[model samples]
Target: MKPLLALALLAALAAPADAQERSGIYQQGEFIDVWNHRGGHVLQMVQTREQLAATGRVVRIRGYCRSACTILTTLPNACLAPKARIGFHAPRIQGTQIIAPYVDQIMGSFYRGGVRERWFGGWNRSREMQVISAREYTRLDPQARFCPSLS
Candidate 1:
C-alpha cells in the first residue's frame, strides 16, 4: 500500500501541465529577422499584445529578444527575467538602410512608461542593435518587474 501511494504521487507530479499553466507563460527567445514587411510585423505585434492582454497571463521575457519581439515588451502583463536582454532598432525598408518612419511610428505606439519616452528620445533611431538588460529596462518602464519565475 505504501509503494502504491508513492507511485501515485510520482504519476501526479509527472502529469503534463494544463493550458492554464502552459499558455500562462511566454518565453521570450532569440532572433528572427523581419527584414521586410515591417508594417505586417507591427500589425501582428499589436494583435498578439491585445490577445495576451485579454488572457490575464504573464509574458516572461528571457534571454535576448530582438527586433519585433521587443515590441511585446508593451504587453501589460509582461514580466522581465533576471537575465532578460532586449534589443531595439529602427525599422528599415527591405534591402536598404533607409528608416521606415511610418512603420516605426506604429511600433512606438505600443510602448508605455519610460520606454515610450526613450523611444521618442531616439533609441528607435539606432541603425544597429541597442541592447538593454532587464533591470535597466524595468528602471525605464516601471510597469515591469523582475520575475525569473512566477513562484
Candidate 2:
C-alpha cells in the first residue's frame, strides 16, 4: 500500500501543469494601463498584435505571457513590459504536436536577451523543450503604415 501510494503521488507530481484561466489589466508606468483578458480558451488570450504596428516606435506589452502570447510579443515592434508575468514553457500546437522551430526561436531570443530562468521554473516536467525552432519573421518596416483593427 505504501508503494502504491508513492506511485500515485509521483504520478500526480509528474502531471502537466494545467493551463490557467486568468484576466486582468496590466499597468506599466510608461503609459496608461493596457487592458488584457483571457480569450479563445484557457492558456490563451486575444492579444492586439496588430495594434503594435501602429505605435511605430518600440511598444512594450505586459500580460499573462506564455507560448502564443510570447510569439505575439516577438513581433518587431513588441517588447516585454516590466509588469509582464511570463509562463516560460514550450508552445503547444493544435492539441498535441509541439512546434519545434517556434519554440526554439522564442526561447533562444529570451535566452539571448538574458531573461532569468526563474521565469520558467514551472516547466520542468514538460517534454516540450523550452526553446522554439522557427523562421524569423520580418521586422516592422519603418516606412510601412499600420493598418487599423476592424474587429
- Top candidate on lDDT is 1
lDDT of each: 0.62, 0.37
Worst 10 residues of 1 by lDDT: 30-39
The count of backbone overlaps in candidate 1 is: 0
Supply every candidate's count of residue pairs whose N, Cα or C atoms clash at under 3 angstroms: 0, 12
| Residue 122 lDDT (model 2) | 34
Q: Kindly list the per-residue Cα lDDT of model 1 for residues 10-116, writing each as its tens digit.
A: 54455345522221122223211111112226666676567556546566665566666777676767766676677788877767888886877888887778888
Q: Model 2: runs farther than 4 Å from truth?
A: 1-51, 57-60, 71-82, 97-103, 106-111, 116-151
